[model samples]
Target chain A: MEPIKNDILDYLKDNSFMDTNIGLEDNDSLTQNGIMDSIGLLELMDYICEKYAIEVPEDMLTPENFDSLQGITNLIVKLVK
Target chain B: MSRIVCKKCVLDSDMPGIDINEESGLCHFCETYVPFSAQEKSDYLEKMEELFREYGGRGNYDVVFALSGGKDSSYTLHKLKNEYPFLKVLAVQFDNGFISDNAVENAKKMCELTGSDYFKLTMENEVLYETFRKAAESRDAFPRLAKYRASDICNTCISIIKQKLIEEAIVQDAPFIMFAFTPGQSPNPIIPLKANFIRWSRSIFEKQLQKIGVEDKDEKFLIKNEVIESMGKEGPRMLHPLCLWDYNEGQILESLVEIGWNPPDLNDSNSTNCTLNSFACQNHLEKYGIHPYAFDIAGIVRSGDMSREEGLEKLHQALSQPLIEEAAKKLNCR
Candidate 1:
């Protein structure tokens, strides 16, 4: 996994009720798999913004940017650059 | 099986996912807990004032307040109006078919005192009853932590409230929507209602309602797709002022009572609005071996907002069996 993806996964594990038994794939939809709910997503967004010191643009708040590890990693990389 | 309660909070070993360290006598949540610092609290209060100033008098109604007619919500409305009289608020109280008559009256009374419009949001009685019943019967429909935050029935109700209020905010062109969530009920004080997030949440909740066997073809429990499309990049923001404010349950009740808010005569100690709450709690306890309010109350205790003894007293307060049986009978799920 990319370092950013690893960090995101670590944060989820630490804070969320993600079932480690079922494990997770990079592309698996977090909301669909019950890894994160709406409130959890808000919390994750806050974490990303604070950790990366990047204010996410409103238009970038798509599932393609947040619903999966790969998507989140890509979004962070795009923002960091 | 032996039961061990947390020394710091009201959580105990009987609750799922609650692990008490025998040596420490503290649950994992309490052990790893961090309270908001004085600086952080001040910052939050400043941010809230900024939000109020920016969104206060922009339109016919600047806010869609989710008033549950509970002590927290009533007090929140009273305080908000007192502090920001410029705000045009439409207080919405959801009538979930099981809400006490007194709750409706209290909601109306608070709105009258606050000089805000009061709107009672009601759905078909049969549909609401079926939804609550399905929520009670459905298992693992929500994630474990979400379940810990509230009973399945309450989670269902709150989701509906969120979706409906978001819709109300968008449709009414309000810049803000407010919910009187206790500090323990949610972590964030402000959540921007981005279009993507709203769409995402709508889809997830639709799936949840479907899982509970509710045919939401009418988008009964969701934001309409057109509303999502119309919102584009962003919509109204959500604020939980209770999370930022100094929270004291005793003071809140006293403040509300001074403003003519009457507490409903209910056996449930945790809630002040819905009569179905006791039934929901009893059902949750029976189903999951957990008192649904344990996590929320525990957070309050951990924050030192409430004494551990008070938290335990609230947690161990006997649920109203008569109310539970009545609700169950009404839902035909007994």
Candidate 2:
């Protein structure tokens, strides 16, 4: 597992409704699985940007870039490069 | 078998994620809570002023205000118009089919008083009524924390309001959409509606509606994908000014009265607009053993705007049975 993905998973556990007991897959839909709502997603975006010190471009705000651990890690990794 | 209530707020051991310490008697939230410092409040106020200064007069309408005809929203609308008289506002009142006649009149009156254009947004009565009915009947239709903010029915209504209001703001090319949510309801003073975030939020609401068994997922209840595509990286920003300023209910009501804003005659202490609120709260409590307003009122008490006793009083206040029955009949839930 990528370190960024681990960080995001930890953040979800700390801040979101993501159940600690449930093992989240890389591609699981955050909203579909009830782990993240609209507000939760916003907070996640703010966290990712602040932690990585990379501003997410508006064009990159798609579900493919943010709806899962894999997608978020990829977006962060690409932006942090 | 015994209930353990928090000493700081109205939350108890009954609610999820609320653990009352044996020694402290404070809930986990209160135990780790930090109030906004004066400096932080000043910064937020300064940021809001800067936002208003930059975007107040550029768009077709400077602000798209959500007017529930409640005291908080009415007072906020009054204050914003007075503070930024140059702003062109389109105040939208989403008629959820359960709004009181008094609420409708109050909405119109506030718009008149504030010199803002009034728009009453409505959908088909049957569809709206069925949506509320489904909201009441569905279990776990929303996330647990979301349920704490409002009942399933209210979550449904408010989500619809947000979706359609964003659509309205986008279609009108408005820069800001204002909600009168109190500090307890939502702590954020401003939420930028980034393009992808808008789509993500709309999709979540769509799933919630589907979970409630609404067969026809109306476009009126969700933002269209094309609307998102047409916009730039960011759309309208959402502003919750009530969180930035002081929130004394007595002072707010007194000020509103001075401005000819009459209070509604409903028996529900927690709501000033919708008659379906009591039924929604009752349904949520029946289904989940939680009062939906407990989280909101608890946040207020935690903020020191209201005391622990006052919070509990508001939490356990007698609901309007007549109003609930009327709503239940309208929705055929009885």
Candidate 3:
């Protein structure tokens, strides 16, 4: 989870112009807190698919699955398993 | 830096990725933009049909159409109803106190003509106007960025529309929310990402909102959180239908006129709905010295609907004091 979270945090900062100074927490609600938006979700989905070599089942593109680093990590771990 | 306007279009140096080739007088965005091939367009239409088939009738309202009573949205509703009749659609229009009378009536008439359920969600104008005033008055960086994105008045109105559409999607169990934003309405596809930008904008707006007497609960509506926690990941997906299909304003207006939809009498030549559009547009122009609709107009030019000269004429509008005054009266921003 830490490695995945770290990679995602870096990706957000590098790719999306997310402010690294704010310091995203593992439990921070990215979308709910307005740190990300619809386009952000699309970018993240694309990144996760390429990074993990797993297509996020369309049904799993829900809020709970990608709400935070923690939730996204869980979804990725489950999909990889 | 001295601002360089695009030779072919209205885009200026302020626009991201805008590189004016000294020889050609065009920017890279315009030079590199290629309209979809016929085969690609056909494939996209087929995919849209597939989406409609899969999502149609899955809920009480299978889709929620964000209706602005503009030609694009009206045409989208028309085509969807005529072409994909099986889908249950709910048209939602947000009243931002500046929506033209004809637009409001047109929205109602379109719903009646198409036999679709319509919801007119009206916002508290006091708060709306105060926010608009702040948008007009505030020169702070984040607030200014908010203005630069959607104009001062439009940002507040659009925030309400966004909140309402998502809620309607959830409440009606609509699996998809359809927007009629054409490729023309999109940005450069590489505009600066608004990371923590909404939160910052919301905070600035909220300060004005509280001063204008809105409750805390209402403030939450302005926050865009659905991408995270609002619907628990099962929220309806926003679908831009026009991006999949070929459309030009002229064709859409002609089709709509045939079906009894008249363009609104408005100040903005490009706008056929909101009365305050020109006001916000002029404000942005005054502040940024760049047309807010540069991308939209450039998109239209790239898509071959209108000549770049025509687009420039529309963007570099001569001053219309009477119209601005009237729109200001409507918004009470003056």
Q: Say which candidate scores most in DockQ.
A: 1
| Residue-level error in angstroms, candidate 1, position B211 | 1.0
| lDDT for residue B113 in candidate 2, whole number 0-100 | 91
What is the C-alpha lDDT profile of model 3 across B1-334, one tens digit per residue?
A: 7778777666777664355777777776666666767787777678767767876776789878889898889998988888888888899987777788899899998999888999988767776666666666644322222333456456556656765676677667777777777677642222111223333334444554444344446444565445423444344666776765666667788989999997777756867887777787788777656455776777777787778788888877764677778877855766
When sorted by TM-score, best at the front, the candidate numbers are 1, 2, 3
Every candidate's DockQ is: 0.59, 0.52, 0.09
TM-score of chain B of each: 0.97, 0.97, 0.82
> Candidate 1's error at B116, in angstroms?
0.7
- Name the candidate, 2 or 3, with the larger TM-score value: 2
The segments of candidate 2 whose C-alpha lies over 4 angstroms from its true place after superposition are A1-7, B216-218
All models: lDDT?
0.86, 0.86, 0.68
- Model 3 CA deviation exceeding 4 Å by range: A1-81, B1-8, B14-17, B31-35, B140-149, B187-216, B223-232, B330-332
* Chain A TM per prediction: 0.93, 0.95, 0.89
Candidate 2 clashes between residue pairs 3 or more apart in a chain or in different chains: none
What's the lDDT of the predicted structure labeled candidate 1? 0.86
List the candidates' TM-scores in order.
0.95, 0.94, 0.74
Whole-model alpha-carbon lDDT for candidate 2: 0.86
Worst lDDT 10-window in candidate 2 chain A: A12-21
